[model samples]
Target: MQATEPDYKCGVEVTLEVIGGKWKGVILWHLKRKTLRFSQLRRRLPGVTQKMLTQQLRELERDGMVHREVFPEVPPRVEYSLTKTGWEVVPILELMCQWGTARLQGRQEEKEMAQAS
Candidate 1:
């Protein structure tokens, strides 16, 4: 019988396909907090190059996770914010963070034990 639900492996693969890049997660994290302009995003991520940030934002916007708004004005203002799909990723991001923290804590404890011995 065909399973009604998506295959777990394919599901994970698809999620990673859209967000596997180093900057994507960081970009998503910031967008989740509040809407911000392009310059604001650049300032928030100090190490990210302008080209890279621009590329990442374009990808996210294409994927429907991020919404880009452009205002016709003297300077042509633009802003970015998370869409409904993007907000859904928040809990997933939190889980990833929690897991990383736990892993780091476990590694530190193991290192301390090794040093003591």
Candidate 2:
């Protein structure tokens, strides 16, 4: 028998459920281009704490949105990249980013108008 998926009707809901955290979208955006080490991810996302980044990465891994690779080297390196499922979100994430920027700009304009009133 085939496994059943979650009861999400809309694709947006399902997508949101997978990447619906503060850091997940940013992490996914970075991973869309190329794989990155843990430290690299942290460096790119300056405001994210080490613990939060680790936790978010782990969650994404569990959700099958990201692939984590651990090397058995002397320094022990770990890298994260997007899975095929994760790659599907690239366009959606871009749209979200555009909408977010537009919303922020609109809010600023509204605030400025209010201040001038």
Candidate 3:
């Protein structure tokens, strides 16, 4: 079912707006493994620029989907993990992943069959 204007006016919409960006899904996927440091996240997501990562992390933090912890040390350290609200998004993501995989497989089979004809 498609969401309406009233749906757009609530927390769900705001959460979607934050996570709907290109890199956000990947970021969330990686975080689902375990809490990660900034550099760790960067390594996992190779193509994302440092600036974009910083921006996305800030947005996630602002949206309450990510918890950022700062360490007092010689070099400043930061780590990120999913908040309770963020954890709630995992099942939705998993279902979407399943659908996407099935859709891709279907399209590939169709293409191959068309080529054989």
Residue 66 alpha-carbon offset, candidate 1, angstroms = 0.3
Q: What is the C-alpha lDDT of each candidate?
A: 0.91, 0.94, 0.87
Ranking of all predicted structures according to lDDT, beginning with the best and ending with the worst: 2, 1, 3
RMSD of each: 5.6, 3.1, 5.6
lDDT of 2: 0.94
Q: What TM-scores do the predictions have?
A: 0.82, 0.82, 0.82
Residues 1-93 of candidate 3 have per-residue lDDT tens digits of: 995754566777766697888788778888988999999999998899999999999988887888999999779888999999788888878
For residue 84, give model 2's deviation from the true position in Å.
1.2
**Candidate 2 stretches greater than 4 Å from native:** 1-10
lDDT of each residue in 1-117, candidate 2, tens digit only: 998877888977977788998899999999998999999999999899999999999999999999999999989999999999899889989999999999999999999999999
Cα TM-score of candidate 3: 0.82
